[model samples]
Target: MINYDLYIDGKWMASTGSSRIEVEDPATRQVIGSVPRGTKEDVDKAVAAAKKAFPEWSRTSAKERGRILRKVGDLMEQRKTDFARVISLELGMPIRHVEKWHLKSSIREAVYFAHMAENFEYEYEAEGGWVRREPFGVIAGLTPWNYPMEQITMKLFPAIAAGNCVVLKPSQATPLCACMLANIFEDAGLPPGVFNIVTGAGGEVGNCLALHRDVDMLTFTGSTSAGKEVGALALSTVKKITLELGGKSPLIVLPDADFRAAAEEAVYSVFMNTGQTCCAYTRMLVPRKNKEEIESFLAEEAGRYKVGAPSDPDSDIGPLISKRAFERVKGYIEKGIEEGARMLVGEVPGEIKKGYYVKPVIFTDVTNDMTIAREEIFGPVLSVISYDTVEEAVEIANDTPYGLDSAVYGPAEEAYEVGCRIRAGGVHINGADAHITCPFGGYKESGLGREGGTFGFEEYLEVKSVFGK
Candidate 1:
């Protein structure tokens, strides 16, 4: 049993409040560990510590901060196996994917951020003036459970590199991984209070951190409703805010495309991480003439994904983060059925009964107004809608409330042309590849700011213009 505690001011401490959050392994529905259920008092202590440490940390050279970040990345690499196991146990990602992609990708994000920080321009001269980018003191980082380490790394690395201290509040669903991350920062010899972790419910510790006047900026990754609440709370003090919110992205397949290949890629896009990712391509648009053929292909591909224990190396899909998520996804699946969407593959209850698992569900004849097609169902549920022409396809793809990401599959030239017309932060053309360095975010309500690449670093920085001096 791994015993975990909150990290504050370079020391491990118990929660200031009288509550504890028990983390469970979704695969087995068993309690894996418990973390401090922090409160407003805990948030106060963390912000005070960060505020005190900011002066020294901000004074440190950029190269020195980059070196420390590199050390942290190295430590993360050394403990890849340990981190992978923890992610599998707590978040219920397949062990193989956790080791192969999740752990390594998170480490790479840190290392990449460090490399970017080394060459980032903190100050530049303009017409009769100089623009300076400085860190916002005491950032409050609130990350989600889906990609705990990746999201935290993306937020913390840049904030620290930009000379800011952080008070991170990772979701209670996967707080153990956050604790492990705190240990890595400690091992890397970061300055006292430069990085701290507070684990608890969003309404308690998370809200407190967002509302804390001492916190200069607030960065959050989660649902839009939650984002709105956090934004509202931060408005009290007018703190800087950056949000990476939800998505119901689309994957459009033209009649000229290879149906088989597109179907496989579409399934992979949404089903990866059990469809918990914010940028998952949940809605797929196909040519009306080839709708039946595309549906057959999608059903065949969906049946190939094996949903089971996260510990199973060969399992393609694992249980959700908790029973609550499982129930919520199930309810959405039921709503889709009641709304008259045709279920082509997988059932609501699915195969597994003991764990919080739902198999891949693909719904055909789904209209844009259907609940499954319109709402952000963060599960392995795919909705297929039909379009008559290229213009119609583009219209359908952009009809949703989200504009975070979209994919176009067809002839290279046609796909590229359609990709240009879509209003999204990022577009995948012909399943080319997902660029880590590209700016990732939405245009409207999907998110307020970008994450990944150079734009992400700018989120933690404040700009000041110095008059002719």
Candidate 2:
């Protein structure tokens, strides 16, 4: 059992750690570990420590801060197995996929920010005077449970690299890995109170951080509804806020495209993280003539992802995060059928009696207006919507509350042209790779602000203009 207390002011406090929040392994639905259910008092302590540490930490030389940030990545590499095991145990992502899916990006994010800290210009001449970039004090980082490792690193490294102190409250379901990260920070020689962790219910820990007057900025990654609540809560303080929220992104296949290869690639893209990704291409828009062919290819490719436990090396797909997630995804599949979308591949029921498992679902003959096509179903479910023309394809793709991420698989000119017409924050042309350095965010109700590379690093900074020479 991995048991931990609130990490505040560089020490573990267990006086209020009696009330425990149990952590479960989704693969077995077993209580594998637990962490303290922190209260508002704990949040207060964490915020106070961060507030106290801000002045000195923010004033530290950029090079020195970069050195610390680099050390963090180095320590993570040294203890890579620990991070993989804890994150896999909590998130139910296959351990075999850890190094590739989670740890690589997490480590790279830390290192990327380390370089930014060392080389990024903190002050530069603009117009007639010099402009300065300064860190905001006491950043409150609230992360979701889906991609626990990378999400935490995404929020943490950038803010710290920009010289801001942080008080983080990770999803209650994934605190063990966050606690392990805290241990790594301590060994990396991060100064006392520069980084703090408070784990508990969002209403208590997360709400407290959002409401805390000391928190200068809030960065969150989760659902659109929850992002609204968090953004609204932080408005009272009028602090800086950035959110990376939900999406119902589309994959458009033009008439000239290689339908089979595109369909197969789309299968891997959508079901990569068991379809829990916020920016996954859930909707596949294909020409009506090629719809049936694409559907057959999608089903064939999806079958390649075999479901099993996280510990099973041969397993390509693991269980959903919890009982609630499993049931929610299961409901989406049934709802798709009820709403008149034909299920091409997938099952409906309690076949695997144990873990929170749902077979990958593929829906064809789906309309843009149908509930299955519009909503963000965070599971291994794909909806294929056939359009008559290229114009209609772009229209159907953009007809959604989300505009996070999309893809177009066709010839260079045609794909680029269609991708330009789609109103998404990002559009991948012909299966292009998503680099960690690129800016990532959304449009419309998806959320505000961008994350990754310089865009994300700058989110933690404040600009000041000086008039005199």
RMSD, one per candidate, in order? 1.4, 1.2
lDDT of 1 by residue, 1-469 (tens): 6667779999999877878888888888889899988888888888999999999999998888889999999999999889989989988999888865577767787788888878899899999899999899999999999997888888888899889999999988888888898989898989999998888999988889887889999999999999989988987899999888888888999889999988998899888899998888899999999999998899888878888788777898998877778888998999999999999998877554678888888888899999898889899899999989999989988887788888989999999999999888889988777666877888777888888889988888899999895
**Candidate 2 overall lDDT versus native:** 0.89
Model 2 agreement with the true structure over 242-352: per-residue lDDT tens digits: 989999999999999988878887888777677889988899999999888888788778878888888989887888898888888888888889999998988785754
TM-scores of all candidate predictions against the true structure: 0.97, 0.98
Model 1, C-alpha of 414: deviation from truth (Å): 1.7
- The residue ranges of model 1 lying beyond 4 angstroms of the native Cα positions read 350-352
lDDT of 1 at 275: 90
Please state the error at residue 398 of candidate 2 in Å: 0.5
Cα-based lDDT at residue 415, candidate 2: 93
- The residue pairs in collision within model 1 are none
Question: What's the lDDT for all of these models?
Answer: 0.88, 0.89
Candidate 2: regions farther than 4 A off: 15-17
